[model samples]
Target: MHEVKKDGILFHRFDHLGHCDRLCHGVFTRQGGVSAPPFDSLNVADGLGDAPAHVRENRQRILRATGGTDLMWMRQVHGTRVHIAEKGAATGTPVADALITAIPGLLLVVQVADCQPVLLYDPRRHIAAGVHSGWKGSVANILGRTVAGMISEFGCRPADILAGIGPSLGPCCAEFRHYQTELPEAFRSYKGPRSHFDFWAISVDQLCRAGLQKDNIEVQKVCTRCHDDRYFSYRAEKITGRFAAVIGLSPPQPT
Candidate 1:
């Protein structure tokens, strides 16, 4: 991933996705916005106890940075439900954990503090997806389900898709004390010392299993808990804000 600064706001872009002229993608950091400490600067999640006005301002800043006309956000229930975004269509926050779109100018956003935001782009079909995958979502195979949704709804071929796993809790800080009951047996292989699980690897493996090429996947590997100063981590700071990972197809350039 590459760091990009637009109008003083810092975000990261996946190199492969960045090269696609039709796509506008970014993983925003918790900086360059109007909000006090704790939720200070760029708190995009409205349900997190942050002031509505501050959250609105922070979202506008992101719109300025990404050039997205509309942002379709999910309620993120840590489930496998995927919402499809339409151009110029407005809707309330749906009770889902993932969003997919083929409409240009409509950004699919997934808010996260520590949960992984998996961005998927099908350059061939000009479709994109934003998935919010926490431990429950991961175990539920939300990543794979989103890919399948793309294939079914947008006629996308999984092999032609590129995935970017945004910053989240890393294995070093992901300790699952009651893993034997909480985590599935298949995830046992990723268990490390102190019962920490490598969710990054789990996401990669899940994406691959969904038919995405291994080389087409990009993992940020930046743990939100480890870099709490740069990001908002629920584990690091319980009463904190949420950052955003957004992806959308750009309108075709005028002739």
Candidate 2:
């Protein structure tokens, strides 16, 4: 992922999806905002103890930075639930971990802190999706579900889908002490030393198994715990802010 700056806001764009004029997507970092310490600057998640006004302001900043008309996000519950956003759809906060849309100007947002913000775009179909996947979400194979939803709902082919796994808890810091029970037997194969797990590999494997070509998936490989300076990490700080990862079709260009 390469960093893109807009209006003092910093975010990352997938190399595969970066040059496409039909879409605008970003994996925002925890920088340039009005919130105070702990939630210092650019905290977008609500009901997490941050002031509502600050969250609203941060969200607006993101909206402006990404050049999106309206935003669609959810109360991510680390489950396999997926929501489909359409043109002229009412913006309501649903309880789901993934949101997909083919509508231009409707930005799909996902909040993250020590979790993967998976963004998918199919240029062939002009479809985009934002997913919030943590360790629990990985276990549930939310990536597969989201891709399947796109295939069924939007006629998007998996091979044409470009996926980007944003900065999150890398294997270096993704330690799981209770893997014996918390994780299934199949997951143990991906375990590293000291009970740490490489979720990046897991996500990539999941995407490939879901029918996307290996080249189409891009993993940022940024560990939130290691780069807490630029990102928020729940493992590093229990009460931290959640950064934003947004994807949307660019508004129709003037004729």
Candidate 3:
């Protein structure tokens, strides 16, 4: 991942996606905004008890940094539902965990604190998706499901898709005390000392199982809980704001 500071706002761009001239994407950190502590600076989510005006301003800052004309965010219920982003879509948030779009200029976004924000792009088809996968969503195989959606809806081949797993809860801090009951047996192999699950590995495995080439996936591996200073961590702080992982197909450049 490459760190970029634009207009004083700091964010990250995956190397695989960064080289694509037709794409505009970012993994924004909680560094530049106007909100107070706990939700301090760059909190993009509107709910979660933050001031509405502050969230709006913060979102505007993000737009400026990403150069997106419009942003499409989901209600994010942690389910496998994937919404297709298109021009002139409805204003209300859709109740889904993933968003896919081929339309240029409509930025697809997923907000997260400790959950993994998986970004996928099919450079061949010029389509992109943003997925928000938490423990529940991971167990549900949201990453695989989103890839299937792209294949079905956009005729995108799995091998043509490039994926990036953004910073989230790493194994060092993802201790699941009641994994025997809370987590399924299939995830037992990922359990580490003291019951910490390596969700980053799990996401990569899910992507591969969905037919994506293993070499095409990039994992940021930057644990949010460990680096709470740069990102908001729900586990580390309990009360914190959400950062955004966004992707969009850029309009063609003038000749």
The lDDT per prediction is: 0.92, 0.92, 0.92
lDDT of 1 by residue, 1-255 (tens): 899999999899999999999899899999888988899889999977888999999998898799877888888888879887765554677788988888878888889999999999999999999999999999999999999999999999999999999999999999999999999999999999889999999999999999999999999999999999999999999999999999998856669
TM-score for candidate 3, residues paired by index: 0.97
Give per-residue lDDT, candidate 1, residue 64: 78
Candidate 1: C-alpha RMSD after superposition: 1.1
TM-score of each: 0.97, 0.98, 0.97
Clashes of each: 0, 0, 0
Q: Tell me the deviation in Å of residue 45 in model 2.
A: 0.7
Candidate 3 Cα misplacement greater than 4 A, ranges: 252-255
Quote model 1's TM-score.
Answer: 0.97
For model 3, how does the per-residue alpha-carbon lDDT over 1-255 read when each residue is reduced to its tens digit? Answer: 899999999899999999988999999998899999989988999879999999999998887788777888899997879898766773568999999998887788889999999999999999999999999999899999999999999999999999999989999999999899889999999988888999999999999999999999999999999999999999999899999999988855668
For candidate 2, the per-residue lDDT at 10 reads: 80
In the predicted model 1, the residue pairs found to clash are: none
Off by over 4 Å in 1: 87-90, 252-255
